[model samples]
Target: MENLFFNHGKDKLLWETEDKILLAISGGVDSMVLLRLMEKLALKETIFLVVAHVNHKLRQESDEEEAYLRAYCKRKGIPFYSIQWQQATSFGMEEAARNFRYNFFQEVMEQTACNKLMTAHHGDDQAETLIMKLARGGSLNSHIGIQVRQPFSNGELIRPLLQFSKEDIRKWAAEQSLVFFEDQTNEDTHVQRNRIRKWVVPELKKENARLLAHAQQFSQQLEWAEALISEQMEKEFQTHVKKQAESWQIEGDWLMALPENQQYFFLSYFFKKSLSELQVGAKEEQLLQLLRLLKKEKAQWQVAFSNEWFFKKSYQQFSLEKNKQVTDEHHVLHYDEGVYLNDREWIGILKNVELDKVPAELEQIGWSTFRQDFPKDLAKEFFLRRRRDGERLHLTKNLTKKVSRYFIDNKVMNAKRATAWVLTDSKNNIYGLLPFTLSYLSIMEETDKIHYVLLYKYRE
Candidate 1:
């Protein structure tokens, strides 16, 4: 035990002599052995140790386990903390417990000013994880299973006992006359992981006695492959993905031009960003379908995920945005200066300025300069709304043109047209396009009495 601690714990600088460490103890043999080892280390090094245990209250012995561990820590003169699960749910109990445990560990570590968090995931856990990954057809990233060390929330998570087998930990605990509590639910074959740990791993060990070692070797190989692939994917992401103000934009054509594996990684990179636990294997088809859509010209589509995340492909540029609560509905409001159109995502204000003073930049798409004519009845009946189909606007005194044809001729993408808003009156006389243009009634000469109605468009 000392050799292992010195070689891996001390030599690797997993924790400094003066550093405070937090251990996640569950009153199991593995965690108990880890606690004992940490105690031995603390005797030689001036380090602080804090123990945290979570009581899920699922078993009758949960309270007993917590009491025993707390008493042990009390006798050892170490600080111990325990939290009970308040909310209970029958479905997804394993996942829920894991999330609750980790969140508690994070909170405790923060409160104690601990620099490192220690866990007791040993060789058996790694073997079971690998087996599950293989069964689920996991990607190269999943092949790494549980790492010895990783970055936790604002600190480091160190699994020092990963190199030790479950049997080895139990044997060491017995040799040292250490006491620990066992949760009998571990023997419940109803749980998939318990079944795998008891039967699948033991059966595999028959073929190779050192199955854990072989699995570690395979993981190392996968790690090497992933390192190379990850470097290339990062470069591709930097080159193609761009961060917009309220969304992320990716160059669709450039992304699709890469190799299929690189493309998968490129999409997976963003997927893992928003959906951290998303399994790429299950959603690969959806990604492929999106890629296919991107290849088509004028393709405008969106896929909504949890937490309001949406992937929108507009022509050759793809954007990932969080969908706002505001829907794309036609909103009609009485004409009032400085009115904000929440549904249209724009602010309407009538600014009084010289007609010739309008910036030439305002002529660009998504910005417009309109001159408002104050007819006594027009001002009273005027309203703001989203553009409607078959609406016509007069380009000349005698010539009227359909607004839809105007959009088509102007080469506006269908995606943008769908959510486009316009300003008009109750009599259906269009005064201005929300973000595109000003009608002839509004576009004036230098001497025209300019209400100078303008819309400042903003992303929702």
Candidate 2:
């Protein structure tokens, strides 16, 4: 551990900042080594340490680990924070425990005014994760392995030790004589990772002595592939993602034009953002199918990713949105109910109201309630659908401009224009396209109350 700290410990690399770091110490070998390294490096001067431990409360010895951590922190004169989670009785114990830990970490960080959090997930753990994900038929994103730097609530979560192997961590712990509690369940085959660690890994290692090394190589290749694909997808989004007068949109035509691999990565990026905001995962196939929902045929579709956000596939665009309880950066309002995007920017709503008897489903489309006082002539068409090729507006009945071209001329982002909902009638006539003007479109009849909702509920 002394040599490791002198040579390449996490303390020097990521802790140079004046951030109070909440170290997630499970009393496992890796975590103990992390605590010891911090001590050895004397990083506490620059980085305040909060030894945060969570008792999963699964095994009887779980609480014991918590006790040991508390005692160790007290002996070291370090402040310690702890949480006990009872929610693991649910089937998704790992996920549930993780969520609880993060929530607690955020709370503690805020209370301590901490700037970052650190975890000791070493390289071998990364390899195991890659193998596990592949064994479960992983996607490109899954193979990316846990990110080196992940976003936490207000600060960042740093995993500097991930570059090292489990053997490295063990050697460090042994050299430092670090005290840590062993969770016997780690050896249980009932857990998938344990089974892989025991039966699968050993057999593979026997068949090919460098299997771990090979897995490491695969992980690196996947990382590079992910980065290259992500770059291409970003360029595509740069070309396609746009903002119209109010609503945001993405060009389906442009997306479809990308190479198949690019399509998957771009769609994955969009859906993963939505999923992260909504707190959902592992729905690559489901989300890929959902991308079609962004075509011109549908004005809006909602998808649930747990409770953080609702994915909106509307107006030829896909986006992640938060619940009413969350703050809106654009509106800067609590935005609980429906909101007519202030300053004519956009309209986002959370209710299930139907406008003009448009056969509304729950939260699929925020139908605009046309006021009886509003002139029907003001609506080029009464039906609500995303803009399409056959769609056109009669500027003077003598000539027409493609809504797509009109949007471009209007300086609306191509991506946003593709997804922006345009009002139309059952006769397939253009009603009023949602404009990104500084104010309501002059076309919006003063007597009419346009109902628009930005947040869409997740589709079943």
Candidate 3:
């Protein structure tokens, strides 16, 4: 057991004499055995070891466990850091405790300048995790179970005991006569992991005595397969996906053109990359629904990806972004002044101005400036607002066209059609479509009276 632990640190982890490791000890047998193994390694290599413990304060024995571990660390002349989780939630106690524990470990690592944080997750834990994930169902990546090493905080989280089983650690602890705290809560069958550990694992071991070894092998194999898939997925992602400030954009046509399985893989990869911290990925039902949405005749649609995020398809582009409420706001604007239509768009009117006399700022290449003459007698107070459904623009005294039909006929993108402002008078007369087109009535020349030159600008 000592040899396996030592070689994993030396060969797999590439541990050097100067390397500092922060060990997350839970006062359980598994972590106690890991602490002993690390102690032995340190004696021979002069490596620095720091012990970090989280007193979850969930059970009556929590204080006793913390005291026991702290005394042991002091006796061993090792640095120890501990924190109490005082803000435990009533619900999701397990997940909350785990998060709190790791956060404390990260803090300890930073304080000690440690480059590696070691945990005591063993093969049995790995098997249980694999079974739980398989039963719950998630992306293929989740099936890989607990990794041997993964990036955490500023360094790496190394699980050296993954190659060892629970029995192996218990056996070593007995031989060494190591003292550790036993949390009686682990025996509660109501807990899913405890249930699996007590019943399912033994049953699996009955079928194959080397169940832990098999589970570890399966995890390694899945990791290798996922690594290969990720390599290709990255290449495809780089080629097709675009990262905007607050969202990720993908070419809908390119995604739909791929084989169905590839499409699923691509989306899974995309979600994993975008929400890596959340550990949320696209499930089969969600992916199938998204595929159906993508293939539909509608040019634009959106669905909730999760509580905090959404999947939006606009024309040929698909985007993943946070949930945002689309507001139908009206802005009353004055001449020579601009109002922000949106975060990235500004709209204003320039009255009585010729094309050649347009302000230099408005003459920038990207500004979508338009010029049109509105009747001098029209209401001075013009409002900018989103196009109303079935709204029409009077082109002339006898010709009027539906604004929606005009947008369709002009091949206006769904995004622009949704956000474009309709310039209307106080009487709800549509005179112009902001930067796109002006109604024919707006272009009609009044020979005997003056007209207002309405200039619109839309910056990116």
Ranking under lDDT, best-scoring first? Answer: 3, 1, 2
The per-residue C-alpha lDDT of model 2 at residue 85 equals: 84
Q: What are the runs in model 2 whose C-alpha is more than 4 Å off?
A: 9-12, 17-19, 43-46, 207-217, 242-257, 270-282, 286-460
Per-residue lDDT of model 1, residues 1-460, tens digit only: 6478657887678888788999999998988888989898898889999999999998898999999999999999999999999777989988999999999999999999998999998888989988888887745676677877789976899988777788888888899988888888899999888999999999998998899887776766777777787787777667777775556778877875777666677787666554554422226566777667655675467876656667887666677766655364555444344444553354444445433343344445764333344322244545665566688877776787888988877766655676566667666778666567657765556555535445454443
lDDT of 3 at 154: 85
- Highest lDDT among the candidates is held by which one? 3
lDDT of each: 0.74, 0.62, 0.82
lDDT, candidate 2, 264-354, per-residue tens = 6777776554345434683766666665554336555667655645556544445554433412122221222333333223232222253
Model 3 agreement with the true structure over 1-460: per-residue lDDT tens digits:
9987887777885467788999999999999998999898888997899999998888999999999888888998999999998998878889989888888888888888999999999999999999998889867777898988889888899888988888889999999999988889899998999998899989999999988889989989999989999999999999998887667888878886887788878888887788775565566788778877766788778877678777887677788876655578888877555566655565555445434554566666767756566555456678888898989987778889999988887767665677778888888888788678887767645483654566666664
Off by over 4 Å in 3: 58-62, 87-89, 245-247, 275-285, 306-309, 321-353, 371-384, 395-399, 409-414, 425-427, 443-454
Local distance difference test, candidate 1: 0.74
Winner of 1 and 2 under TM-score: 1
Candidate 1 global TM-score = 0.74
Q: Which stretches of candidate 1 lie over 4 Å from their true place?
A: 86-88, 134-144, 218-239, 274-285, 295-298, 306-308, 322-384, 390-410, 419-460
In order, how many clashes per candidate?
A: 0, 28, 0
